[model samples]
Target: MLRVFQECPELKLSSHGRKMAKFGRATPEIEGLVVASGLSPLIMCSLDTGDRRLMSTFVEYWHKETSRFHLPVGEVTITLDDVTSLLHLPIIGVLHSFELLHVDDVVDMLVELLEVSIAEARVEKIQCHGSYVRLSWLHDVYQMKI
Candidate 1:
Protein backbone atom coordinates (compact mmCIF):
# COMPACT_ATOMS: atom_id res chain seq x y z
CA MET A 1 0.00 0.00 0.00
CA LEU A 2 2.86 2.40 0.90
CA ARG A 3 4.66 1.47 -2.31
CA VAL A 4 1.46 2.00 -4.35
CA PHE A 5 1.00 5.47 -2.89
CA GLN A 6 4.66 6.29 -3.53
CA GLU A 7 4.30 5.21 -7.17
CA CYS A 8 1.03 7.14 -7.72
CA PRO A 9 1.07 10.62 -9.22
CA GLU A 10 1.34 13.49 -6.72
CA LEU A 11 -1.87 15.32 -5.98
CA LYS A 12 -1.73 18.98 -7.01
CA LEU A 13 -2.53 20.81 -3.78
CA SER A 14 -3.44 24.49 -3.85
CA SER A 15 -0.59 27.00 -3.36
CA HIS A 16 -2.86 29.65 -1.81
CA GLY A 17 -2.43 30.22 1.93
CA ARG A 18 -5.37 29.69 4.32
CA LYS A 19 -7.94 32.46 3.92
CA MET A 20 -9.39 31.96 7.41
CA ALA A 21 -6.02 32.50 9.06
CA LYS A 22 -5.57 35.79 7.24
CA PHE A 23 -9.18 36.76 8.00
CA GLY A 24 -8.31 37.32 11.70
CA ARG A 25 -11.02 38.49 14.11
CA ALA A 26 -13.85 40.80 13.18
CA THR A 27 -14.62 44.12 14.87
CA PRO A 28 -17.39 44.37 17.47
CA GLU A 29 -19.86 45.72 14.90
CA ILE A 30 -18.95 43.12 12.24
CA GLU A 31 -18.91 40.33 14.83
CA GLY A 32 -22.55 41.10 15.67
CA LEU A 33 -23.48 40.97 11.98
CA VAL A 34 -21.57 37.67 11.57
CA VAL A 35 -23.38 36.16 14.53
CA ALA A 36 -26.73 37.38 13.21
CA SER A 37 -25.87 35.80 9.84
CA GLY A 38 -25.23 32.47 11.65
CA LEU A 39 -21.58 32.36 10.64
CA SER A 40 -20.13 32.92 14.12
CA PRO A 41 -18.78 29.38 14.29
CA LEU A 42 -16.73 30.00 11.16
CA ILE A 43 -15.19 33.07 12.80
CA MET A 44 -14.34 31.07 15.91
CA CYS A 45 -12.77 28.21 13.96
CA SER A 46 -8.97 28.21 13.67
CA LEU A 47 -7.23 26.77 10.62
CA ASP A 48 -3.89 24.99 10.28
CA THR A 49 -2.06 23.12 7.55
CA GLY A 50 -2.54 19.41 8.24
CA ASP A 51 -0.24 16.44 7.63
CA ARG A 52 0.36 16.23 3.86
CA ARG A 53 1.40 12.56 4.15
CA LEU A 54 -1.93 11.68 5.83
CA MET A 55 -3.82 13.73 3.22
CA SER A 56 -1.94 11.96 0.42
CA THR A 57 -2.75 8.57 1.94
CA PHE A 58 -6.43 9.51 2.13
CA VAL A 59 -6.40 10.72 -1.48
CA GLU A 60 -4.92 7.39 -2.54
CA TYR A 61 -7.71 5.51 -0.73
CA TRP A 62 -10.48 7.68 -2.18
CA HIS A 63 -12.76 5.85 -4.65
CA LYS A 64 -14.10 8.33 -7.21
CA GLU A 65 -16.91 6.03 -8.34
CA THR A 66 -18.62 5.77 -4.93
CA SER A 67 -17.01 8.87 -3.33
CA ARG A 68 -15.92 6.71 -0.39
CA PHE A 69 -12.55 5.86 1.12
CA HIS A 70 -11.70 2.20 0.54
CA LEU A 71 -9.66 1.77 3.70
CA PRO A 72 -8.34 -1.63 4.75
CA VAL A 73 -10.86 -1.78 7.59
CA GLY A 74 -13.93 -0.75 5.55
CA GLU A 75 -15.44 1.92 3.33
CA VAL A 76 -16.18 5.34 4.83
CA THR A 77 -17.68 8.61 3.62
CA ILE A 78 -17.63 12.12 5.10
CA THR A 79 -21.14 13.37 5.76
CA LEU A 80 -22.63 16.83 6.40
CA ASP A 81 -22.90 15.80 10.05
CA ASP A 82 -19.17 15.21 10.05
CA VAL A 83 -18.59 18.70 8.64
CA THR A 84 -20.89 20.29 11.24
CA SER A 85 -19.20 18.34 14.03
CA LEU A 86 -15.65 19.00 12.86
CA LEU A 87 -16.07 22.66 11.89
CA HIS A 88 -18.83 23.56 14.36
CA LEU A 89 -20.81 25.09 11.55
CA PRO A 90 -24.57 25.05 11.33
CA ILE A 91 -25.74 22.58 8.66
CA ILE A 92 -29.36 23.79 8.55
CA GLY A 93 -29.85 27.07 6.76
CA VAL A 94 -31.30 28.62 3.64
CA LEU A 95 -29.27 27.33 0.73
CA HIS A 96 -27.60 30.15 -1.14
CA SER A 97 -27.43 29.64 -4.91
CA PHE A 98 -24.73 31.72 -6.56
CA GLU A 99 -25.35 32.71 -10.17
CA LEU A 100 -22.66 34.20 -12.37
CA LEU A 101 -23.53 37.84 -13.03
CA HIS A 102 -22.36 40.16 -15.78
CA VAL A 103 -19.38 42.44 -15.17
CA ASP A 104 -21.63 45.49 -15.10
CA ASP A 105 -23.84 43.78 -12.50
CA VAL A 106 -20.79 42.84 -10.45
CA VAL A 107 -19.59 46.46 -10.57
CA ASP A 108 -23.03 47.64 -9.50
CA MET A 109 -23.02 45.15 -6.62
CA LEU A 110 -19.56 46.24 -5.48
CA VAL A 111 -20.55 49.89 -5.62
CA GLU A 112 -23.73 49.31 -3.63
CA LEU A 113 -22.30 46.85 -1.09
CA LEU A 114 -18.93 48.51 -0.53
CA GLU A 115 -20.17 52.11 -1.00
CA VAL A 116 -17.34 52.76 -3.43
CA SER A 117 -17.45 54.99 -6.48
CA ILE A 118 -18.33 53.48 -9.88
CA ALA A 119 -14.82 54.25 -11.11
CA GLU A 120 -13.28 52.51 -8.10
CA ALA A 121 -15.55 49.51 -8.54
CA ARG A 122 -14.68 49.27 -12.24
CA VAL A 123 -10.97 49.44 -11.40
CA GLU A 124 -11.37 46.62 -8.87
CA LYS A 125 -13.27 44.56 -11.46
CA ILE A 126 -10.46 45.09 -13.96
CA GLN A 127 -7.82 44.21 -11.35
CA CYS A 128 -9.67 40.99 -10.43
CA HIS A 129 -10.11 40.18 -14.16
CA GLY A 130 -13.68 38.93 -13.62
CA SER A 131 -16.73 39.08 -11.35
CA TYR A 132 -14.81 37.32 -8.56
CA VAL A 133 -13.02 39.71 -6.18
CA ARG A 134 -10.41 38.78 -3.57
CA LEU A 135 -11.56 38.50 0.04
CA SER A 136 -8.49 40.56 1.02
CA TRP A 137 -9.68 43.34 -1.25
CA LEU A 138 -13.12 43.18 0.29
CA HIS A 139 -11.59 43.27 3.77
CA ASP A 140 -9.54 46.33 2.87
CA VAL A 141 -12.59 48.07 1.45
CA TYR A 142 -14.57 47.17 4.57
CA GLN A 143 -11.82 48.50 6.84
CA MET A 144 -11.75 51.74 4.90
CA LYS A 145 -15.52 52.01 5.23
CA ILE A 146 -15.39 51.53 9.00
Candidate 2:
Protein backbone atom coordinates (compact mmCIF):
# COMPACT_ATOMS: atom_id res chain seq x y z
CA MET A 1 0.00 0.00 0.00
CA LEU A 2 2.94 2.33 0.51
CA ARG A 3 5.05 1.31 -2.47
CA VAL A 4 6.08 4.00 -4.96
CA PHE A 5 4.95 3.67 -8.62
CA GLN A 6 8.12 4.01 -10.62
CA GLU A 7 6.31 3.19 -13.90
CA CYS A 8 4.49 6.56 -13.88
CA PRO A 9 6.03 9.13 -16.20
CA GLU A 10 7.19 12.53 -15.03
CA LEU A 11 4.53 15.27 -15.30
CA LYS A 12 4.98 18.41 -17.42
CA LEU A 13 3.11 21.54 -16.34
CA SER A 14 2.56 24.84 -18.16
CA SER A 15 1.26 28.10 -16.73
CA HIS A 16 0.66 29.92 -20.08
CA GLY A 17 2.19 33.05 -18.49
CA ARG A 18 -0.97 33.52 -16.46
CA LYS A 19 -0.81 34.84 -12.89
CA MET A 20 -2.92 33.53 -10.02
CA ALA A 21 -5.39 35.83 -8.34
CA LYS A 22 -4.56 37.01 -4.86
CA PHE A 23 -7.10 36.49 -2.10
CA GLY A 24 -7.75 38.67 0.93
CA ARG A 25 -6.18 37.61 4.21
CA ALA A 26 -7.61 37.83 7.68
CA THR A 27 -7.59 41.24 9.31
CA PRO A 28 -5.29 41.94 12.26
CA GLU A 29 -8.36 42.26 14.48
CA ILE A 30 -9.15 38.58 13.82
CA GLU A 31 -5.61 37.38 14.49
CA GLY A 32 -6.24 36.55 18.15
CA LEU A 33 -9.41 34.64 17.38
CA VAL A 34 -7.76 32.71 14.56
CA VAL A 35 -4.84 31.78 16.78
CA ALA A 36 -7.16 30.72 19.58
CA SER A 37 -8.96 28.45 17.12
CA GLY A 38 -5.63 26.76 16.12
CA LEU A 39 -5.80 28.07 12.56
CA SER A 40 -2.89 30.49 12.70
CA PRO A 41 -0.72 28.13 10.66
CA LEU A 42 -3.06 28.59 7.71
CA ILE A 43 -2.43 32.35 7.75
CA MET A 44 1.26 31.79 7.02
CA CYS A 45 0.54 29.63 3.98
CA SER A 46 1.17 30.98 0.49
CA LEU A 47 -0.94 30.43 -2.62
CA ASP A 48 0.13 29.47 -6.14
CA THR A 49 -1.47 28.55 -9.42
CA GLY A 50 -1.56 24.76 -9.25
CA ASP A 51 -0.55 22.32 -11.97
CA ARG A 52 -3.59 21.22 -13.94
CA ARG A 53 -1.74 18.43 -15.75
CA LEU A 54 -0.64 16.83 -12.48
CA MET A 55 -4.13 17.17 -11.06
CA SER A 56 -5.57 15.54 -14.20
CA THR A 57 -3.15 12.67 -13.91
CA PHE A 58 -4.22 12.10 -10.31
CA VAL A 59 -7.86 12.25 -11.31
CA GLU A 60 -7.26 9.75 -14.08
CA TYR A 61 -5.77 7.29 -11.62
CA TRP A 62 -8.34 7.83 -8.87
CA HIS A 63 -10.80 4.97 -8.11
CA LYS A 64 -14.01 6.40 -6.70
CA GLU A 65 -15.47 3.03 -5.69
CA THR A 66 -12.48 2.30 -3.48
CA SER A 67 -11.80 5.95 -2.65
CA ARG A 68 -8.10 5.37 -3.30
CA PHE A 69 -5.51 6.20 -5.91
CA HIS A 70 -4.92 3.25 -8.22
CA LEU A 71 -1.31 3.84 -8.98
CA PRO A 72 0.97 1.34 -10.74
CA VAL A 73 2.62 0.26 -7.49
CA GLY A 74 -0.21 0.23 -4.97
CA GLU A 75 -3.42 1.78 -3.69
CA VAL A 76 -3.04 5.10 -1.87
CA THR A 77 -5.44 7.13 0.22
CA ILE A 78 -5.08 10.08 2.56
CA THR A 79 -5.60 9.49 6.27
CA LEU A 80 -6.70 11.73 9.13
CA ASP A 81 -3.09 11.86 10.34
CA ASP A 82 -2.04 13.21 6.96
CA VAL A 83 -4.55 16.04 7.24
CA THR A 84 -3.55 16.75 10.84
CA SER A 85 0.16 16.86 9.97
CA LEU A 86 -0.25 18.88 6.77
CA LEU A 87 -2.80 21.42 8.00
CA HIS A 88 -1.90 21.47 11.70
CA LEU A 89 -5.57 21.09 12.64
CA PRO A 90 -6.82 19.44 15.79
CA ILE A 91 -8.03 15.87 15.24
CA ILE A 92 -9.22 15.07 18.77
CA GLY A 93 -12.07 17.30 19.80
CA VAL A 94 -15.81 17.40 20.22
CA LEU A 95 -17.51 17.12 16.84
CA HIS A 96 -20.38 19.54 16.38
CA SER A 97 -23.23 18.66 14.02
CA PHE A 98 -26.55 20.31 13.30
CA GLU A 99 -29.32 20.00 10.75
CA LEU A 100 -31.87 22.63 9.73
CA LEU A 101 -34.68 21.21 7.63
CA HIS A 102 -36.62 24.42 6.95
CA VAL A 103 -36.16 28.15 6.36
CA ASP A 104 -37.64 28.87 9.77
CA ASP A 105 -34.98 26.69 11.38
CA VAL A 106 -32.26 28.53 9.45
CA VAL A 107 -33.73 31.87 10.55
CA ASP A 108 -33.81 30.70 14.12
CA MET A 109 -30.19 29.49 13.96
CA LEU A 110 -29.04 32.81 12.47
CA VAL A 111 -30.88 34.74 15.17
CA GLU A 112 -29.55 32.59 18.00
CA LEU A 113 -25.95 32.40 16.76
CA LEU A 114 -25.57 35.93 15.40
CA GLU A 115 -27.75 37.49 18.08
CA VAL A 116 -29.53 39.44 15.35
CA SER A 117 -33.21 40.33 15.31
CA ILE A 118 -35.56 37.75 13.75
CA ALA A 119 -36.40 40.25 10.99
CA GLU A 120 -32.70 40.80 10.29
CA ALA A 121 -32.09 37.06 10.17
CA ARG A 122 -34.97 36.59 7.74
CA VAL A 123 -33.62 39.36 5.53
CA GLU A 124 -30.15 37.79 5.52
CA LYS A 125 -31.60 34.40 4.68
CA ILE A 126 -33.46 35.86 1.71
CA GLN A 127 -30.49 37.89 0.52
CA CYS A 128 -28.20 34.89 0.67
CA HIS A 129 -30.65 32.73 -1.29
CA GLY A 130 -31.91 30.65 1.61
CA SER A 131 -30.19 29.05 4.60
CA TYR A 132 -26.84 30.75 4.09
CA VAL A 133 -25.31 34.18 4.74
CA ARG A 134 -22.23 35.74 3.16
CA LEU A 135 -18.96 35.37 5.03
CA SER A 136 -18.39 39.09 4.64
CA TRP A 137 -21.65 39.74 6.45
CA LEU A 138 -20.57 37.37 9.23
CA HIS A 139 -17.24 39.17 9.45
CA ASP A 140 -19.03 42.48 9.72
CA VAL A 141 -21.18 41.07 12.49
CA TYR A 142 -18.10 39.84 14.32
CA GLN A 143 -16.50 43.24 13.95
CA MET A 144 -19.58 44.85 15.37
CA LYS A 145 -19.58 42.41 18.28
CA ILE A 146 -15.98 43.12 19.17
Q: How far is candidate 2 from the true structure (C-alpha RMSD, Å)?
A: 8.4
The digit string of per-residue lDDT tens for model 2 on 14-131 reads: 4422221122444454556678767676655443447667776786788889989988889999887987898787777776565655889988866766677899888888898877
Tens-place lDDT per residue, model 1, 8-77, is: 7775665333665555565565667778877677765653446787778888888999999999889999
How big is the positional error of residue 90 in model 2, measured in Å on the Cα after superposition?
1.8
lDDT, candidate 2, residue 124?
84
Which ten residues in a row are the worst by lDDT in model 2? 15-24
Clashes of each: 0, 0
TM-score of each: 0.68, 0.51
Write out the backbone clash pairs for model 2.
none
lDDT for each candidate structure: 0.76, 0.68
Q: Against the true structure, candidate 2 has what lDDT?
A: 0.68
Badly placed stretches (over 4 Å) of model 2 are: 1-47, 93-95, 101-120, 135-146
